[model samples]
Target: MELLIKWLSIALSSSVKFFAGPLLGKVYNLPWWQTAICSFLGMMVAVILFSTVARAFFHKYMKGLFNRNERRITPNKRRMVRIWNKFGISGIAFLTPILLTPIGGSIVAISFGTHPMKIIGYMAVSAAFWAIVASIGIYFIPFNFH
Candidate 1:
């Protein structure tokens, strides 16, 4: 039960914030493999949920909240467009764990009209890669957690 709690905690943390999973694993002294798998699964779950179900729900029920007529150009949106033009899905996926949360990244991809399966594929690969990197870095590096 205690171990299950720890695993769930790691998963929950990564589901919301990717970096938190590695930090929590270090604090808990969990093995690198456990950290990697849990974090990857957590992020993938978020990506899937946001890319599919939440997206449809929001488009259907929350359409009035967005107000497309009120849309205006912003520097951030311009920059995102530039990035999208330059890097495409690969760039977005690479930046997902590093710069964007899984849900946020999925939303960005979905807004751009990318296929859902493509979003899932790229996100899965990115999550797996980053999970491995973060878990290894956190567990191997000695940090003064005091």
Candidate 2:
């Protein structure tokens, strides 16, 4: 139970900040590869939770929190829709992690009518790649010790 809570917190934290890779890595005290894997897993869990359960809940109970101009960017939506129509799930999965936080990216992908499975697969891959790269970069970069 405690472990589940900890992992859930990590997922939520990573979902809120796409850049939480390093923070999570440190907290888990994970080596570079493990950190990358855990971060990616956390992000994937977040995407799934947001797209299914949280999305409906937010729409029903916390709509105001997500109601913003950002959500209604018509031109951007059109562009995203076009891209989604053309590239299908791959485009959204590839783009979401780079372009938005896990929750926000998943929301946009869902709004664009992306298939949930594709969104999950692609976003998971993208998140894994980025987390690995970020984790390695952070772990390897040397800072001068004063």
Candidate 3:
């Protein structure tokens, strides 16, 4: 029971941020590959949850609101556009895990009118990549953290 709880805690923590599950697994001395898989699953949970909810809300209400309002574009929107033109969806997907939490990344992707499926797919790849990198990277630390 205690072991299950410990794993649940690790998974839940990782769902909020890309690196957290691997960090928790390292602290708990779990095997590296196991840590990577667990961390990836956690991030996927966040990505799926956030992307679906946000996208549904966006399409159902936010889209109508924006269309009705004719709101002027903000500077942030302009910047995002510039980045979008330059980097495109693949770049955003690649960077999301490194630069933003899974929730934040998913929201941003939704805001940009990305398909929810695409967001989750990108997140899956990014989460897996980062999980492996983070888990292995943690193993190389010369100084003991705990």
Clashes (N, CA, C under 3 Å) per candidate: 0, 0, 0
Return the TM-score for candidate 3, rounded to 2 decimals: 0.83
Q: Per-residue CA lDDT of candidate 3, range 53-128, in tens?
A: 8788878887776677567889866765676788866667677767777887887788788888888887788788
C-alpha lDDT of all candidate models, in order: 0.87, 0.71, 0.79
Kindly list the per-residue Cα lDDT of model 2 for residues 1-146, writing each as its tens digit: 85556555555666777657556665555577766666787788888887787657656876665566566558776777787789877777777666768887888776655567777878888888788877887777773323
What TM-score does structure 1 among the candidates reach? 0.91
What TM-score number comes out for model 2? Answer: 0.67
Candidate 3: 10-residue stretch with minimal lDDT: 137-146
Error of 2 at 23 (Å): 3.9
Better of 2 and 3 by lDDT: 3
Which residue pairs in candidate 1 have backbone atoms (N, alpha carbon, C) closer than 3 angstroms, thus clashing? none
Over 4 Å off, model 1: 61-71
Cα TM-score per model: 0.91, 0.67, 0.83
